[model samples]
Target: MRLEQADPKRLVAESYRIEGITDGECRSIFIDWALSLPVGVDARQAIKRLLAEYRGTAPDHPMTAVLRAGLHKAPQARRRGGARGRRI
Candidate 1:
């Protein structure tokens, strides 16, 4: 996805401008960015692009971990079937 396609475009832009931003601050921004994502957008891919663009300049930045965490976060599994399926 292109940068413009990212949710909260202003937040993402501001995040990159932060000089020596703290881990906590990055976490907050990350949450905003995540929440702003549009449906059907590949979060992992979006994050990867952001990481590559920003993290490339500072691989050790605290934001890297936060973004990486988002990429690796697994979706929760939904339970199916009704009580009738149980061994009664």
Candidate 2:
């Protein structure tokens, strides 16, 4: 799905509602998601990508610095292999 096809703010609001998250928690989640993208992507683009990936679903938890770290690690993990050189 394309980022232009979805309303990211609305998606985050609805997902937060469905997940029963407090307003503060939701804001934190939104901010975290916004900051967790590739270097060249802006917050708006980050939110759009997140909305595309997580449409109709609630995030597992409020966003955090750790979540951003994991996002950074994902691409590296995809390229690296296990001890036997098998893809993880």
Candidate 3:
């Protein structure tokens, strides 16, 4: 089903549910989902993009928070140094 046919928020919520994510974490995941898309891809494609990258993995609230703040910061915790990476 397409994102327009399916609720974008609900899709995101379901993704969170599958990953056992919290509500606060949803916003970040949703944002990351949005950013991952090509410039003009539709919402369905956007959701698909997010799912491809994030689905199946458990949500990390702290990581979500950083990603929500800015995609560039999401990997900071995983970096060998404190340098920020490229933005999503």
Cα TM-score of candidate 1: 0.70
Q: Candidates ranked by lDDT, best first? A: 1, 3, 2
lDDT scores for all predictions? 0.78, 0.47, 0.48
How well is each residue in 59-87 modelled by candidate 1, as lDDT tens digits?
A: 78788788888877588887657886564
Q: What global local distance difference test value does model 2 have? A: 0.47
| TM agreement with the true structure for every prediction | 0.70, 0.33, 0.31
For model 1, the superposed segments whose C-alpha errors exceed 4 Å read 75-88
The lDDT leader among the candidates is 1
* Candidate with best TM-score: 1
- Extract clashing residue pairs from model 2: none
Q: Summarize candidate 2's per-residue lDDT along 1-79 as a digit string, tens digits.
A: 3553333345444444554555566666555545544455555445545544564354454532223333453343454
Q: Where does candidate 3 clash, by residue pair?
A: none
| lDDT for position 12 in model 2 | 46
